[model samples]
Target: MSSTRQFSFEFFPTKTDAGHEKLMQTAAHLATYNPNYFSCTYGAGGSTRDRTIDTVKHLNDVIKVSTAPHLSCVGDTKADLRQLLTMYKNSGINRLVALRGDLPSGMGMASGELRYANELVEFVRKETDDHFTIAVAAYPEMHPQARNFEEDLRNFATKVKAGANIAITQYFFNADCYFYFVERVRKLGIEIPIVPGIMPITNYTRLARFSDACGAEMPRWVRKQLEAYGDDTKSIKAFGEQVISEMCERLLQGGAPGLHFYTLNQAEPSLAIWENLKLPR
Candidate 1:
């Protein structure tokens, strides 16, 4: 990896005190690596907006890390988003992951004020005038709901043209998928850094479910191997670290800008992968 490449972790707001405590512990541990930033995810349809803001503030104040809070367009009005942008700017939180997040369960898309992430990016630029560094999502394996690969690439390009400064992809097992996606985007004249998202495979069942839901492909070989480990948590984690670390190595060596880990609010799995790869802290 380039020494100048950026690395970050993603976390979500927790509903319970116990969950909050665990997230804090995890954040403290990962902070040791001195990541470029830590990002807090916004819940579907702005359901956990307040909690997300709280978590972002805690990380910035207590953890003392550059924090990025996700701002989604789903279930929000332009006025609501403008208010949030003002609040975050006043709080010294200048980085944002702009997304058109999933609608809350059973909520229809027609209810949302914004229909796409590109629009959100545009609105942010119009409102803030470069006050924030905006990060947007890239789906290497084509978004599940996209009409086709070409359409997905076009959608991603739109976000970049609308003023996204960076792109973080959905996790995938195959590095080739990331490479192909980057090459296709480059053909569209977009040169923004595209960081690969890494999901450490600590639990096969949960990994499979998340992959299925997000349209990330888990290679059959990897799935069968993980399945063979069955309930052996130790074996699962061991195999996961080795596999993910190797994949990360290839991604970096092949010119990936950096990595963004989907930490699932856990430290050890991602920490192990970092150590296994011998990345500089």
Candidate 2:
């Protein structure tokens, strides 16, 4: 983490060889902009663990960009987690996006050795002794599974206290939610940088589905505008670019530490928003 505002992008491990090659090309394109780091996400229960490690290694060693790999507690034993940690450490990857991952369908709640993100954070610290710069997840609008906002905030505070160095929030359209969340976190004596996650709009149908799944609100006005556009992808993209660009402006101006984009393995959509912001290359 630099004193300067950080900017990063996230990608998921693609399944097929061609898809992985294409993803590497995408990462190479984004690398031109010199993001703070590029992160690769693993599948639930570490289903795509090997692919994640490969993508991260290629991004860091081949593409020559600093890379962080996402690690989750769900569907993994402590030994499983420890082995991955050792592999990452051996590979010279120093940053991590630690999470209490979503349980796969039909998986018992009693799945992983660690139950919560705070516990995972604590485990990482105890295992690594500061070898990694751990970034945890935050929910400005509150986690979908959280019982209430207060409980969610408390959970976040617990993670911070467990030795998370920073947080990346779930994407939200409402800048106000992010500001309000930060305001409250400060009240709880937590001051780590909570970078806002940005999701560029490309396909309305896909975006809507993701929003619903993640419990991120799509403001009525935005939803209506997108619906009106229907299958007009051009208009949808233009409107999306404008809306998200403006929101990013507000977040940065309001003193947000940085942005972490959910790029969905595409370079152009996130790049369109980045170019609009005129961020340093």
Candidate 3:
């Protein structure tokens, strides 16, 4: 494994003051590990646009680390996106995670000015001319809305061709799935770094719920093990750490570019995994 491989963490903008404080502390804690950058997720349909910007700014200003704000095309106008790009540029944020975010429940797809993530990446390049390092989403198991695996791969290639500098995948448990996805994309002539998104298993119920919603496959054995633990929080966390740590080792050994953890605004789970991997801070 390359010692200089990139590592990053993702967060969502918090709605409450307390939540914001907690996230700040979490970011601070993780910063000690020298992650490549921190990413803040934009709310669906641009609902929390202001909060996302504010959170990104706060992390950059306070944590003194490069922060990337997620920019989603759904429910946004070209003018609105232009303004946001300028704002982030002015705030000294030079990285972005471009996404075709989910539409809010009941909002039709036609409501958005931009239709896909490729269009969003194109717009960013046209508007900013490489001022930002653009990162786009990829799915190993296939995006939930995709009609099939080929279509999903093509869509990801479209984003890369549109100027995405990197690709971060949806979190998955199975290492073979990630390796296969990378090999397939390589065959498609997409060479951008595809970083595996890692979700530490802290809460089985919550993890299962999220996995189901996001199309991440939780293997039957893993599911059964988690289910057997029931409400045993300690055992669940220990088992989760062991499972995720081993997965990380395999991914790194298999030549994944790096890891991007879905921190979910917490510190310990991700930190524990980092420690388990014995990665340099």
Candidate 4:
């Protein structure tokens, strides 16, 4: 609902006990920037439900930061999702990023009644009386499963009508993709805030594989810079900072609502980009 650009962050819950400390440290460090809200990603197929709840609740309770927990309906029953919603309400988290998460490896099929994110959005609406402001994933490049770009827009519209308050895209390297998608969706009259998802490319190989999996293209210029940095962490991070900072500038200038950084459990790139933006408090 804010006309000015705002910032939010995304993190995934860790698998080990030590990961808890690392995540807490990262959250505390980044909290000072006063992000609009921070999200903790739920693993595909409900893999980290407990951990996601724990991390999100901790941020709200201990860190006193607004938090959103990613919720996937890929393999959860209606009862299961109801319980999860109850947990979120009890933890004082009022925001959720509803997703029809990717299927588990080798499954090749959804294991739950809600096959799409809109269905999950409907479920959330039915469970709560607008207490939760739901966010859903949008694909600028077109979701791989969508029949076409138009279908993708229609799907996004359906989610908004089903009560999703925000839409955060999957990460992409092309700003044009985001701009064009926004134009098209605006024409559809949905009009909810569509925040761009930005992922700073720190590790070339790891980022490349993720982009491939998500249907986001990694441009040749980015690939060349990554290779040039080779094994040097400092150089790689500097390159990442420059790349993400510029991306954020372009998106804001082009009329994006805000930027969402997929921090990958680290604060350096996200923090650097925030400083570069110089957003007023």
Assess each prediction's global lDDT (C-alpha) against the native.
Answer: 0.93, 0.93, 0.93, 0.88
Which residue pairs collide, candidate 4? none
TM-score of each: 0.98, 0.98, 0.98, 0.95
lDDT of 2 by residue, 53-129 (tens): 99999999999988999999998899999999999999999999999987888886848789998999999999999
How high a TM-score does candidate 4 get? 0.95
TM-score of predicted structure 1: 0.98
Cα lDDT of candidate 2 equals 0.93
Candidate 1: count of backbone clashes, pairs at least 3 residues apart or interchain: 0
lDDT for each residue of candidate 4 in 188-240, tens digit (9 for 90 to 100): 89799899999986787788887887889878998888888788978888887
Winner on TM-score (2 vs 4): 2
Off by over 4 Å in 1: 1-3
- lDDT: which is higher, 1 or 4? 1
Give one clash count per candidate, in the order shown: 0, 0, 0, 0
Off by over 4 Å in 3: 1-3
Higher lDDT: candidate 3 or 4?
3
lDDT of 3: 0.93
Least accurate 10 contiguous residues by lDDT in model 2 = 103-112
lDDT of 3 at 60: 93
